[model samples]
Target: MTRVIDSAGSAYFGEAEGLLRAMRLEEALESYALAERSGHDPDACAGGRWMCHMLLGRYERAWEESDAIAARCKPDRHRFWDGKPFEGRRVIVRCLHGLGDTIQFIRYAPLVRERAKTLIVEAQPALKRLIEESRVADAVITWGEREPEWDQQIEIVELPRIFRTTLETIPAKIPYLDLPAAAPIAAYDGATDLKVGIVWASSSYNPARSIPLKQMARIFEAPGTAFFSLQAGAERSELALWRDRIVDAHTDERCVVPAAATLKKLDLIVTADTMMAHLAGAMGRPVWTLLPFHCDWRWMKRGEDSPWYPTMRLFRQPRAGDWESVVDRLQAAIEETIKGRRLVPPGDPGAQAT
Candidate 1:
């Protein structure tokens, strides 16, 4: 995506977005403040600064920014859920962010249910079916779908803030999301090889999150590995040349239940910072998430493993746009996995334990 945005505070805020992408958190913070002073959306700019603070591992500062933004924005502004407790209140948790966001943060549902008398989830239509299978909510509804009733509401992304989550306090439980009952994925051609699913692209809104499919040629060279295309959308067209090498596992784009079923059959999932990574991690499956240098704050400041998902491994670029080294590491890891295949068989419950 281009850095040229045409809207209030676009100049400074847009520059801040670019800065964040470049891993310049401190300068991004200054630009966010400048954007707010220049009449850009204060809440939006604060959200940027909140992410920057989180990337810097300054969780307390991030929480402080969240508090300030919560105070300035009203309930109608669609960013509620302050630090107040809601032990016995009827609550509605609305999914207002991307699918990966909902998939990642939905781990907090059981905690919410423990406190709230009842909890309703207003989720995106694409995720409603999968979310329902989780059995974490009293009820699940889609965007335009009607609901019985809700006494109070909170944006799903705000759950971490309301809970005052720090690196250590993060709910790192796995398999929080469940797969709906569906037919298993069609059989793969290389049954004897390690079955692995791969996704190389994210939404066009953030092209930086995507890796060129051509750059991933190394992983295909891993011996005893069967590659599957879990990738969706126009990006699937990129797989045309590699169709003979990688099995195309895509069915309907709108329905994700089938994909979840497919994931259950795979030994491992390798994807960018997209919903697939979150889905695989949430399902307690072994997943390796490839990230850009200017990655999202959720990945944290630095680490190979993620605190949010113990089963997940992160492969970040050494510097901005250097996917070659990332792929080299990936190829080596896949080879290592192949060598240790006998220790942890495919579909073994112990595979996810690591």
Candidate 2:
């Protein structure tokens, strides 16, 4: 632990990771904060710290730190623009985390690739192969025995701020994900009504970000809404209780391909603060994203409208774990959407009815 403190005492790249793994969240966040103030380019470690702050429900501070990080990186945009484009420039998208992250960041692939001939680095074997072959990247490289050298590389999460996206300019469009085709699955032969893709839980990154599986019973109370299970990882086991109401897409072998296809079939996706929410936004699908009392900054500071995906309607918890209120508000919206009263973008005077 002395070495851990020593690492934290200095502006080291892997310091936050070690501190985080040691469960010193507050200390880790503080260390990152200190590093940023001390003329350190916190880089991806800074991003991780912001994510931790959000996960721990310290949102105001998280937003403050994220804004700081964004400010720090702003100068790079100019430097990058001044340089020659892709003439030996290597813009690296570090997606070696999970499928949802890769899926979420894939929205920026086209723009990043346009700026520089790019190489995508993915950890998951499935996504690595899919991204390599698909239209998302010029080339895809998986983590291997050697770290392939590159001239200039940026994390995909940085793309939005680099593009200067605000509440008015979210690149919200669907089919952002393009996976290879495989065998077709059974159609969602539910009660041919309002199809709602339900993602109650996420991979165990932030437990606070997820709502309980049992709380989903509140959504089922919405009459005539067909729910499909989109929960991935260990959370998929929770679907057994809602077997009748759900279509089992998680068990399928062609995981990413079918999931993307299934998302195309849905009228609406109701999800938590996971990558699915981002995926739904990317696809430009009509979605209701359930948010924590203090949400991820991309959802923006206020209102249900997300710049990330204009079609996505946000339902925030009035307080932590207040899924009842969140679900109730979403239910009313779903009822309206089902009856042809769509949830239009906020600020539309006509969007509000008497």
> Which digits, one per residue and each the tens of the lDDT, describe model 1 over residues 167-268?
888898778997655564458533778999999999998898999999998678776778999888899999988876898998665867888888888899
lDDT of each: 0.85, 0.64
Worst 10 residues of 1 by lDDT: 1-10
Give the Å shift of residue 118 in candidate 2.
5.2
Return the top candidate by lDDT.
1
lDDT of 2 at 96: 46
Badly placed stretches (over 4 Å) of model 2 are 1-90, 117-123, 129-134, 145-150, 161-170, 179-184, 189-191, 252-255, 341-354
Clashing pairs in 2: 92-153, 174-283, 174-284
Model 1 segments more than 4 A misplaced: 1-19, 26-48, 73-76, 82-84, 180-182, 186-190, 342-354
TM-score of 2: 0.66
Query: Can you give the lDDT of residue 281 in candidate 1?
Result: 91
